[model samples]
Target chain A: MQRVSQRPTYKTIVSVAAAVAIVAVILALGAQKNFGPQQYGQLVVAGLGAGAIYALIALGFVMVYTVTGIINFAQGAFVMLGAMIAATIYGDASSGDAVGLVIAAIIAILATTLVGVAVERLTIFPARNADTLTLIIITVGVYIAIQGVGLVVWGTSAKAFPAFTTLDITDGTLRFWGIVLKTQTLWIWGTTALVLALLTLFLGRTLTGKALRACSVNKEAARLMGISPTRMSVFAFGLAAGMGALAGIVLAPATRPIYDMGLKLGLKGFVAAAMGGLVSSPAAVVGGLLLGLTENVAAGVTKSGLKDVFAFIVLIAVLLRKRGIFAAGTDLERP
Target chain B: MAADSYRSDTGTTTAPAGNGKESAPRRATMAGVVVLVALVLAIGLLEAFQPGGVDVSSLTGGVITFDTTVRIGILTIVVVGLNLLMGYAGQVSLGQAAFFGLGAYSSAIFTTRAELVGIGSGLEGRWWWPWLVMVLGMALTGALAYAVGRPILRLRGHYLAMATLGLGVMVTIMFRENLGLQLDTKDITGGSDGIPGIPRLRVGTFEIWPIERYYYLVWFLAIVGILLALNVVRSRSGRALRALHSSELAAETVGVDTARFKVRALVVSAMYASIAGSLFAHFRVAVSPTPFDFLASLELVVMAAVGGMASVWGAPFGVAAILAIRELVRTRLDLVIGGAGGEQEAVAFGVLLVLVMIFMPEGVVVRVKEVARRWSR
Candidate 1:
């Protein structure tokens, strides 16, 4: 114990050990549930796809919160803007091609990143001296503004992604030992994983990523070491917006991007961010996918239909637990 | 600037009762006189103009029919209560619509049921019973807010916002699903169709049916509400709220009971919403869950913030202005904007919110004050 206490980075090693054990348990239990090979396989693909989008938006939310010291209520609005612009540019109001969609989505992401920077630079920077409540009010005001803008541009009607054909060699079911996997779900799993793995690497190995993480943890020390927080904040916002645009694109097919989609998506992302303590990026990625799964699974089990009630139940449980809301003041006890 | 302590992370805080600080010799009559004059003008002008009716024809005409305006006016009062809670008090509550709905439904039931069960059988409750029901209903709702406030208020920022959002949604679901609360053995809430034919209000022999009459009544209520909110804002408790709004630590260190203040603010806001709802119940004679939702709550928040959160009188003006804008945007601009058939309003609302945040963060009140300052010279 004395030696352990004397060790410089003992807590860090312990954290890793705990993380591994918890992951191992979750995997073991996840494998034993209703999630058979087909379900498990589908969960991975679909989960990752959804997770990637959530990860990006969630990262943006956390990043903004890190520097501004408050949540950006407009983040989801930014996501919607990204998706809507992509949809519009990818095709005329009348129609579009495959390449057009891809190009438009990329442009939307890039453009929105600039928007992210501009918002932080102009709207947020001026009010850094304001109180938190004032800051919150400012953000809420921004949120309404974004919503209004969307309403003017897109109207209340829901927009649809271009039609697509499903390609499944197994024909909607991959039949191996009575387990069936859908092709679309399969794609989501792969894409999300690749992106998340890349993000993990970026945070661990890259200079920009390190700077962002460092700034998030300790802004003053980072500034002392010559990191331009303003630039980093903008960079973080850009990365998050780009990711949000991606999330919007991926999600559009499922929920169909509506003017109101941002509110719900933003709320869910906030939930996931809070659920993971807003400290762990990996946890957030997993947390978001799990939240989606939790809702769907709860709906399946209860049959009451998980629309409004499901979110409240999870939120209430998470909130009132003995360990502060989102595990505040309590260390994450790894299983 | 101490960057080390300047962490973005938020935590739950223990708020204390307000610091009782008086800035000026009590200009008590400035507020009182304003309410009295606004009331007399609102009522006297309507009667002088002879704005009367439930008639659809008059409503269709371009004239400012007294009835609809008054009903909307009353709704504004309820929203004012909501605004004070959200705007000045620094608490986000989405359950006002539910409280308003409940108040409207209960008040309707109180008066109508009294008329039905006791037709001079001595059990005939006082005509003012509806008023009682309104207060009781609002109080009960305020109690609900308090109950919801305790744990829910423990949430920080967005978490609180979403939780309040969840609360609003669940309450809507409850109103839709719960059978015991319905009227006449029908879904009586009429569910999606909404409850129409809400009985009109009566004050001593003055049969309040015309929107014009209700308009005066509502404005009267609104004036009262504004005054009440102003009192709350200027009160010792209001200061604590402002303190908590800035820094909970700073506020608590100064000996303010933050939790109690939050609860008080929430309850007071609910009461305001309840009063407004009661007026709405009598005026429109209709109430719907649809009108009171997350969007409604958001709109109220926007109204308060738009007018200026720090401004005492801005809440009422904000509600009045937003409603007027909605009417105008839908009516005056209908032809120009393809018969109001597009996402014009929503887009405008979003843009307005953004613009306010970006341009006038102090809200319209501050700008108005600035103009007044310049003009006074």
Candidate 2:
């Protein structure tokens, strides 16, 4: 038994060593390009900002998957809805209207949360007993439907969303040394940290959150214990949707919100969630940050057009490694 | 071989039935062949008699030209392969379009830039060049599917689905960005514009062109593809696939080699997409990345589902139904919604996919058959 256990530790060490070597090589390559610390700092900052949003979105993925055993494709659509609705409510907020923007953001998140609940109730809940493939396809359908509706309502034009700042929204950047940081980036990080703290506390302390966790651990056992799995499923969806909406609204100011922006962001978030084996929220947050940093730095070192490609490559690599190391036991194990 | 076992299993329960049980599948195959011949004859007659082709705009509320039929034929080949993989093998490939795009871009790049690719200008305009490229493309796509499927098919359900989706997006990006090649002089894949003016396919001196003649070639290959899929579904490997679909562990316990069978199914399906892609490139006389995007892959899945994934004969019907709906939306949606663009069609497809999966997971063909059987009784 000790020998069997020792194998994983050895494998983990080798994997960690390999990862370190690869990072060192990439850093050496970046140095050869003659880019100073300033450029590197900018890339790190930008990556972290993007990573924070991805972490928020990844939490939604982890939340839904643990409870429902579904990889919700429509999670991206919730993000899109939050951004689009918020933009619509606070039209042309790039000039600054702090109170108006806050009101719009609140309304958008609430509406999107309801949208998530409705999606689960109408589409997912009805077919709760169906196989995984059917459920996955259903979520995909929901995504397509939402995106279509978004197009019809908002048109194909990119909407303007203001950076959250007390000063003029247009001038929200802060410079320290040679590194420039957007105030919105700070907002994104702060918001993500607050949400994470709240989430940890809720799951750790609250009865409802514990019930939800119980359902995720084992649905039938939770049901036997008198916890309604169905209600918990609804709650999970709504909570995830709210998180997705928050991520989108915050992200919109950084990059102008388009109807189809969620597809890419949602996909990246899925990659992050997958990095956590689709089970651990904290791990997914770490995955998101790592993904963001790697892709940003890689793109900075190479061609920008290949930026999106790196996320998928990372996904494939992570999946392969996970399959190799966690082959015998994992959440992915089938009965 | 599996068909014989299936028949015998049923034969034992009804020994007195004799040859009656065996004739059912034979009859279905006969009906399929007859339908194909009839379709060909009807289209051939239409072309010979009405040179401009008949328009049934009033009936369908949309004009389905010969061009549309050609498209249906091309898509049928892909969807049939999809049916075998998804329906029989119970594997989902959200990146099937990548294989199709690979086949297309292979045909496009090789033929258009034969000299550029250092294959010399000699074979660039040869009649057999495109055909050779098509076969090579299928082989290449199959190899890729094997490499990808080995690792990917190991991840069941949602993990597999997401992995394939990521792959499809990655491949599409590669096509759009010219495989990340920064050539200052000449553009490979022509970048976003893609390769245009791809030469029409030919058999010696006879050119397959003007839409009418091309229809024959497309449908003929499509029929061949259908026949091939039907054969595979009835074979021992097909039974193994069905077993794997039900429960991989059980299949493995039976010594079915589930992993190998899954990978084989993926490879076969990919080859079918490659063939269809080649045909699409030749027929359209141009190749672009847009048609083989993630949405296109979803469209293929939708077709497989709508037509009854398990039924090989349902491929053409599924393609026709989807294309018909798309045409309907294109033509008539503006009147209903006012200035409806691509949005209405997307909504229609999305709703249709959800409704179909929820209400009739077995697909419309099987449901229709059940209804017909009931009504006949």
Candidate 3:
């Protein structure tokens, strides 16, 4: 028992050592003579905003995976749907139309939630007993179907929506110490913090949230305790869909929402979740922020076309280093 | 020999009882051969009978034609490898297209961009250079698969899928960025432009041109792939894969070396994809990153799923069925609906995959065969 307990400590030490080594390398690169401090600051700001969005979507992945034991590939599609639906609703709104933007966000979130529920009922619920690989493939199918729907609904053109603020292109933008920032970035950061806080509170205080947690911990026990696992799983999907939509709606102002944007965004978030070992919410948030920062820094150093290349490289490196990525704290003993 | 025990362990239970209750692997291989011959004949007859552009005015303007059959043939070769990995080894990989792209780009680079990389002023003009490049491409991709499959195969289910997805995306980014590999003037992979004007493959005395002749070549290779896969499914390795698929622990207990079998399946599948990709490069006389993206990977999985994951003989049927439906939707459904855009085929495939997985996980091949046998009785 002592040796078994000590093994994970040794492994944890190695994991931390490897992570620190990577960070040291990144820091060394940043300290180069040609790399300006201001540029590094800019990268950090952009990374924070990007990481917030990733954390929101990663929360969706963790929520669904914990409750239903399935990785919802359509999670990214939900993000696209939110952005596109909101854009369609708030099309060409005037500068002062913040109320309209709010309404559109509400509608988009609700609509995406409905789609998530429909996916669970239509595709996932039917093949609930199938193997894990089959379920993942099914989600991939759902993702494709939703992308097709996005193409049909919005056509191939990209769409842009008004941000939550009245921040204009010039006067409303903030300039602090030669660094330019947008009001939308503030909104993104605030919304992410608000979601995380609310989620933490809900899970801690609310009976329904606790039931969902219980479902994640043990489905049969929850069922025996008179909570319907079906309802919890459905609720989990709905919650995840709402989070994904929120991320999309917030992100659309920063970058125009296109029909196929979900693929990359979803993949990034999944990578973040995997970094958390696919189970921990706080860890996923940290993972998202770290990924966003590292990718931004790497992109700043290299070409921007390889910005995403950094994220995948991190994923592979982390996956290789951590043999317990799929085992530790993921309820692996359930099966 | 242990194929029956493997099949039974997997709970397929759909294998029919023969007149003499003959061995399952032999029976399955014989069926595969029959299907291969029938497919060849059917494709031949279609090529001979289908109205060409000169015969029918409507057909002249359409994009889907006998060339689509050739595309299906090429894709059939790739999907056979996917079927073996997913069906027999019970491992899920979404990076098959990455291997395919690697093969195509390797062939393209060796044959066309050799001079750009300073490998060949004379080798590029050789008659057998492309063939050598193709073989080298297969070997490289197989080695890559072995390296990647080692650690990733340890992760079960969706984690493995996500890791492979990351791999696929990385491959695309590398191709898109050209890996910073530059010839004094331009990027090596040609970036989005890819490597165009790859020299067409040649036989001893003749260049393989004309769509019909290339179609035969591709189908011939695809048939060979099918036979090779059937042999693998009938061999001891096949049973070991099936055993791992059913229960890795049980297989391990029986001294099956589950990890080695898995890596073997992945290497075989990767080689199969690489060969198909080499054919694709030669046939198109060009190579690009566009066709081998994440979507292509998903489409390959869809082909495997729609055909039947656990059956080796389902690859061609899956390719033909999915492509035909896609062609129909792309050409005809747009005309009927009038406003659905060009993504209807993707939508149909998505729906088909879901429905098949939910209701008919055995896929079209196994289910149809079972029905036919029962009806004959």
Candidate 4:
């Protein structure tokens, strides 16, 4: 009975500590001579934008883990591949303008979804019996394969077509106190919010969405219910991959996408997922955003080396704080 | 889907499967090891016999067998330790190389700074005393591993991998920062540029001369390491580890202290790596802090994975294979493929990783399995 009570007490302390920490951070940021209200606002917008990308990638990580009980390290590579394919489509002469870029985004999303489907069907499907680590190695193998192929098709030189400066209608910085806020930051926030609204709908209010959720919750039982977990895997991967691709296209104007961009981006995304206990799909998005804000703010306020250090610190804290962030079986309804 | 693929034109009237499908190709692994060893030895022998090239070795004469043998001995020991951790224990560790570099620096500091520290400053110091200090250095390094491995190894799967990887990165950063310890009075750890003048082991005027001697030295340690690993794996404790592969939860239910086993696995693996580090410091006669980062850890992971984990013989050969391929591409592939020649090797290895999946998913040893199956048939 004492042990039982202790568990909740442990949880309460952590939640309280987390709340205090966030309050302290915001208070501290507002208190800062350099980061006044306007700067904090801008930071939130930028953080949310970056966080959405991380959330999308985290979605794939959690979805795959739900069914397979293994983190697909290749998820990040998928994000990278999705972005690259999208960039390639847009690079072509047929799609060069704003309208064309939008079309290219759709084409790229479609192409990337197919790639995810192919990856599931061709590689991971056959190795069901292999150890979890072997599966990871296979994904790492997938990562290496994608890198080579991506590099071969597109050279090592970084590509940033359709620059990161679109939709800058605000076109000026918002100043209040000593803080500074960029117009693009606001644009990114608005765009991310719009995309997220659509995602929440598709996931919470649709039949196909329910099917995908069911598969992640329990592959075998979901199959018994005629959900074809394998097919769900394809679509789950597609949706997540598509989300990541959209992020890549959106952020392309901020920081250009490159072949190797996925690895680092993927790391941050996984951290975000883990941060949220891979719970409450929206938590992933919030976790990603929070992580981005924390890191960026930390970097701004302190030394840059802390960025990497900050990730592990958060990982250990959250991992210790929560149980089953990647708790399997959330994708499907409870039996 | 393929289960019903064999429904032929006879309306799927199949003969009841005779005595069920025989077990997977387990017997093939034994023969595969033999052939693979022979192939490796043949290649080694050929290379040893036909070698004529300008050596950029920093040593005087730059062709001593002792120094050359040292390099081989060092890498073998390090990779062997790695095999114990990743291959036997089923832990994906990329920190082996980092631990290795730490051991080297630890030992290197001990030997190079004895006089400055005012402990014993004369010819009375035995020639092999440097090695003795090196052992102490390794113990210290192993102690560090022990502290870190216990709590961190508790993390399941990739979380543990990332944590350990973080430790490696942290150590690498610290190693580079040139944080030196003042031993008694002298400066140890060589700071940034690293310790420059490490004396070579000499036998009077007749030094252990030539690169061939180093080859012999490496092979000797390699044999010892193989025997040690073989003995441990065959022991009762080894069975406990192998059992984890079968069913972790079930193994725990059966009275195996799973966490203790994991920690033990990590410590044992750390000791091997520490020994490797000591050998490297004494042999190379110089220690630097650049090559022991996360990438090296990844390369080590690649070695164990590509070789098919849980094999003692495969780990060393895997190392040799990766290094050889790297060296081969750097020197030879340049003429065949244009550009700086550096990127091609990584590209090729990446491609090889993918091909390993699609083809011999079990790796190159598949041929041996096939031969054994034919015998059985």
User: By lDDT, who's the top model here?
Assistant: 2
lDDT of 2 by residue, A44-143 (tens): 9988888888889999998998887788999999999999999899985556567888899999999999999999999888878777777788899989
How much does candidate 3 score in TM-score? 0.92
Off by over 4 Å in 3: A1-24, A27-33, A167-171, A321-335, B1-28, B45-64, B180-186
Candidate 2 regions exceeding 4 Å error are: A1-10, A166-171, A323-330, A333-335, B1-22, B51-53, B56-61
Query: Could you give the C-alpha RMSD of every candidate to the true structure, in order shown?
Result: 7.9, 3.7, 3.6, 8.6
lDDT of 1 by residue, A142-239 (tens): 66667677777777787766532231112243555554444444444554566677878988899988888788778889899898887887777667
Residue B104 in model 2: lDDT = 95
- Which candidate model has the greater lDDT, 2 or 4? 2
- The C-alpha stretches of model 4 lying farther than 4 A from their native spots are A1-11, A14-50, A82-97, A161-174, A299-302, A320-335, B1-75, B104-133, B169-211, B277-290, B325-340, B355-363, B366-370, B373-377
> By TM-score, who's the top model here?
2
Where is model 1 chain A poorest over a 10-residue stretch in terms of lDDT?
A: A326-335
lDDT of 2 by residue, B92-158 (tens): 8888899999999999989898776678888987899999999999999999999999988887777
Summarize candidate 1's per-residue lDDT along B1-377 as a digit string, tens digits: 11111111001122223344632313333654476567557545645655664333244454334444564566666666765566555666645676666676666555554444233423224556667678777878888888988887766555566567777766776555532242455454455556666556677667775555665667777777766676666668767877776666688999999888887887887787777777777776776667676677677767766666555456556665776666656656767765564356665665566567556666776677667769999
Using DockQ as the yardstick, the better of models 1 and 4 is 1
Q: Candidate 3, overall lDDT? A: 0.82
